[model samples]
Target: MQFVFLLHEDEAYFEAMGDEEQKAVIAEHFAFVAALQAKNAFSSGAPLAPAMTGKLVSVSGVEDGPYADSKEQVGGFYMIECADMGEALDWARQCPTAKYGRVEVRPVPDYGG
Candidate 1:
């Protein structure tokens, strides 16, 4: 099975980190991902730009986020192919973002059957 891990960083937590601390945190994540790649447990992932750079185009006039009340936005994600959900979650738990952010591990559905 494949899993999508959406990492979300708390706004307050992020703001609390100094510039160097923030960079260290991001470096930790990069190191963690590199380790996963070395072990062949990582497939792909990338961090998203700040919410200020995000566009809110909803069906309804629900322009939120940068507009207002946007907390804990998704900062990044990892897509990994695994033997089962257990393995996938194990990988997610090792994510550096798991320290201050939530790592949402959800299996990707297949409709090509």
Candidate 2:
């Protein structure tokens, strides 16, 4: 099974970090990803820019940025192929982001065409 882990962080919380502290936080996750890849437990992952860079595209509605002004925003994601949800969640638990915000583990839909 494949799972997509959504790493959410409080934008303000992250921004509040000192430059060195923030770099350390990012580096922690980078090391984790590399380790998982070496163990063949990681598929792929990447950090997302702040939500302020996002656009709300509504067909006939307003398209806007800075989305909701919420404290929490999705900061990144990882797609992992695992034997089961249990295994995937174990990896999620190791994420450094968990210390700061929430990690949403969602199963990717399988659309066989």
Candidate 3:
């Protein structure tokens, strides 16, 4: 089975951190990836650019930015192979983003594509 860990955080809060603090946070993410690789669970993951750089498309047509009302934005994601939801949850708990933000763990379904 595979799961995706969606990392959500307050972009403003992260941007407010000092340079060293930001670097530390980035380092933590690297460490997390290393840990996942060690367990042969890592598939793929990457941080998204600022929300402002994204666009939203709906029935109303395309719109500028993600435009969410909440302060939290999706900061990154990690796709990992695991035995089951239980194992996926364990990995999510260990994610560094959980310390400063929230991690949403969702199982990936096979669509035969």
Top candidate by lDDT = 3
* lDDT at 28, model 2: 93
Position 79, candidate 1: lDDT: 83
Candidate 2 on 1-113: residue-level lDDT in tens?
A: 78999998888887888999999998999888987888787888889988878888777876656776567889999988888899888888888988889899999888985
Between prediction 1 and prediction 3, the one with superior TM-score is 3
Worst 10 residues of 3 by lDDT: 62-71
Which rank order by TM-score, best down to worst? Answer: 3, 2, 1
Query: In model 1, where is the ten-residue run with the lowest total lDDT?
Result: 61-70
Better of 2 and 3 by lDDT: 3
> lDDT tens string, model 1, 2-105?
78999877666877889999899889988988887887778789988766777788777555456555578787788887889998878878888888778999
Candidate number achieving the greatest TM-score relative to the actual structure? 3
> What pairs collide in candidate 2?
none
Which scores greater on TM-score, model 1 or model 2?
2
Error of 3 at 9 (Å): 0.4
Candidates 1 and 3, the one with greater lDDT: 3
- Per-residue CA lDDT of model 3 for 1-113, tens digit only, reads 88999999999989999999999999999999999999999999999998999999989999888697988999999999999999999999899899989999999999989
* RMSD for each of the candidates: 2.4, 1.5, 0.9
